[model samples]
Target: MRAPAANPREPRRHHYVPRLLMKRFAVERRPGQFQIQAFDKSNDRVFATAIENIAVESDFNALERDGVRVSLEAGMGKIESAAAEPIARIVQGGTLVGMTMEDRAAIDLFCALQFARGTGMRAQFSALAEGVEARARAIVGADARLDLVGDAEGMKAAALQLIVGSLLEFTGRFNDKDLLLLQAIEGEDFLLGDNPVAMQNARQFGPYGNIGLGVPGIEIYMPISSRFSLAYWCPTLLHQMREGAALADQRLLQARAMSVVGQGVTRAAALAALPEIEALRARLRRIPDGHLAGAAVAADAGNVTRLNSLQVRWAERFVMSRDGGFDIARRMIADDSAFRQGMRPRLD
Candidate 1:
């Protein structure tokens, strides 16, 4: 069933009110498949709640029909273009992008696990506005860099968006699995009745709190199927001063894996094709606009080349990660053995 209209217009520039903006709506791609999601802003959880081209009249459906904009009975309801991009394709059983192709069979199993975490975590924090504040505090701790605590205050949505921006920036280099690890950290129950360490420190490290057995107390930190996505991306943003992308834990692990296997990664093939990729990237550089139709074509081709180049860097980063390299250098590190054990990892 659809939620009754709370107000004619969605809240804007408002303080932290625990309002649930129904996220699920019917976006029919085919006859039976519809995309539905419940994005809890207060908890920062965005989960896809997909079903067949639904016929139900739920709050989400109402929200979709009547967008976040306020409706005007006496006036015209304004329509504006959406800035967000729709998912190009929803993988079967809903495999979020970036998961290893080797692990595609467990789609339903994976989503169920994610739902459990996001559901449990959001529920736990739905109340306790103070708890919400505290959670926000954890994100903006002494070591926090996204400046989430200070930037763009007063509005809950803005604060949450800033938090997302920061997370997007922070998790850039780490894999989605690492973020999943953080999600696991958020979900696990942390209390030390007698002991101070395991109860306090166990959640941060996997296996201790059980990787798949439990759900987190907070949704923002809950696990999702899109794991390890940032493990090899946005290194500069993730660690402003950390030298290389491998500074992120998961990337380091991948580097180790590459080192052990002795270079069978597709990254090598991608790197071998660098001149072609770079030439494509250079062609993209010539395009003046980021939104023109021709620009889109240029971008599509550029993105492929970039992806290939990124694959090469990722492979080298993988090797570099395996070694104890801490700097971002060139020439020496680019070489295999040096990448295997010496100075900084190369960037560019």
Candidate 2:
């Protein structure tokens, strides 16, 4: 069997390591007074209210510390209100160092509580790492796309790797703003350069390939995981769609058969189909603005059985909702142990 993949982080070994977070925040800035704020909630703080007030700078490179600065453009949003709180990580200079929440119910839904029950490695990363290797080979070998490299399965695997490896280094959140980066760079290799937020330490990778467009002065490198379909799974699916389209130009056989994640027929399309995930959206949106994890059990005896039985379904829904629809489903999953059991990763 193929050896279990090594951890994606480079250096492979490190004397001092930063702990992986369940909840985090990030910042990015570009020219023309535009900026992108990447929020990484660690999938842990499921209940943590979505903090909204925000602004990104134009020449953000000039910031002395990370991206922290007075809001030049206060975004009209707030994660939670008083009396009922939310979990939030403080971000300064592009580092998430601390967090806050309003109540116990909120805490119950966060990554702290959902650590295992609904916890999982980021799916976008999982799929991409498995997909890119194939695509990369398609680009490298043979004179033409039709005359090109390997089997469909193998090409998908290579594409997945390249994508995942690139994501591990993305500093941007999965949002509309990231498209520019995707447009500029060539998906064939490293996203190139440093995190736009920090022109200094350059670990972040996939810009989706926006570099060729000439983004200017500050070279931004983002952490690859930060790039793994942030906010929701919709954009992740969108990225794959575009990738498939690119493959189509390359005359890839399977490109035409793409589907939403979890809804497809073939191994190539399995993760693409997202039917059940689509079904649970309405129920999920009811989740209070708190943590993203409190999805095992409901807070009362009345919710026990039904909610528990629905845990896996809830996770299925959680992965599908492009908006806040699955957030409510997460609440149900957090309160029920039976639900927790249903959502397990399948040990066998």
> What's the count of clashing pairs in each model shown?
24, 85
What's the true lDDT of residue 280 in model 2? 37
Q: Global lDDT for candidate 1?
A: 0.26
Query: Which parts of model 2 have CA positions greater than 4 angstroms off?
Result: 1-101, 104-119, 142-348
lDDT of each: 0.26, 0.26
State the lDDT of candidate 1 residue by residue for 232-282, as single tens digits: 112222233233322333444454455556466655654555555445444
TM-score for each candidate, following the candidate numbering? 0.20, 0.17
Candidate 1 segments whose C-alpha is farther than 4 A from its true place: 1-128, 131-155, 173-348
Query: Taking the tens digit of each residue's C-alpha lDDT, what string does model 2 give over 280-307?
Result: 3323332221123322112232332222
Q: What C-alpha lDDT, on a 0 to 100 scale, does residue 10 get in candidate 1?
A: 51
Top-scoring candidate (TM-score): 1
